[model samples]
Target: MLMAHPAVLRDLVEQYETLSALHAEDGSPESQQRLNDVAYTLCVSTGTRDVDAALIAARHHLPGARVEDDSVLDEEDTPKPPAATSAGAGI
Candidate 1:
């Protein structure tokens, strides 16, 4: 998989976090689901199996942005969760 620029990743993370927080609060289920989907997409875009590599990529592209170890991508080889029944339902 082609890696996205760090800036892109940073933006994605920001958007994901913002949307997620909103989703947790008053956002519609559809909006929350969309945010989750974006985060999942960003995680999968980095082909590296190493979570650190993916995090580094994100940091590289976004200088001054802190990419925490916790932001590492999930196990790429593992099966993804079942599809959501509706927006935000699967997440």
Candidate 2:
């Protein structure tokens, strides 16, 4: 599969994180739209089905990521329930 450059992936992750930190679903439409757009782009770039998986894949592909680090993608790594700031939330 084609992979996005590390720089691009880094930027995408950073952008998504920044937007999420600044806005929620109840925020302005423009911020919400931007968050959704970044999440979609992350999924596409990582060839993953969802933003969470995409984020894992993207982080794994980034520079300095441990190639043998399966832990990052492990189910144990997933956030617990009741959290509201997930990447999939409001997308």
Candidate 3:
């Protein structure tokens, strides 16, 4: 089996955690089961047999890897303030 890219593995791990937290908050039974099925399949189909193993392998392979947080996306969506105009400065 081809080794999974460190970035892809990291994305899956982060997604899984996000889904898990969502499920914990307002999860339905069916949604939980479905999430479990898809999550396990994702782990196995990648290089690792399970989620824990995948996480470990990813960390081992890429020590400096970082999982981007949602705050980055959120901040990008905010509108930037208009630049201040100077009376003497040229446009």
Candidates in order have lDDT scores of 0.61, 0.87, 0.62
lDDT by residue for model 3 (1-91), tens:
7756767666666767777778733688777776676577556746667766655655555547455322223476755778887878775
Give the Cα error of residue 91 in candidate 1, in Å. 62
Q: Better model by lDDT, 1 or 3?
A: 3
For 1-91, candidate 2 gives per-residue lDDT tens digits of: 9999999999999998888888645698988898899999999998988988889989999989876677455587765568566787677
Number of backbone-clashing residue pairs for each candidate, in the order shown: 1, 0, 0
lDDT winner among the candidates?
2
Models sorted by TM-score, best on top: 2, 3, 1
* Model 1, span 36-55: residue lDDT tens: 57656656756544434654
* Candidate 1 accuracy as TM-score: 0.47
Alpha-carbon RMSD of each model? 16.6, 14.5, 11.2
Worst lDDT run of 10 residues, candidate 1, spans 65-74
Query: What stretches of model 2 exceed 4 Å from their correct place?
Result: 72-91
Candidate 1 global CA lDDT score: 0.61
Error of 3 at 38 (Å): 4.4
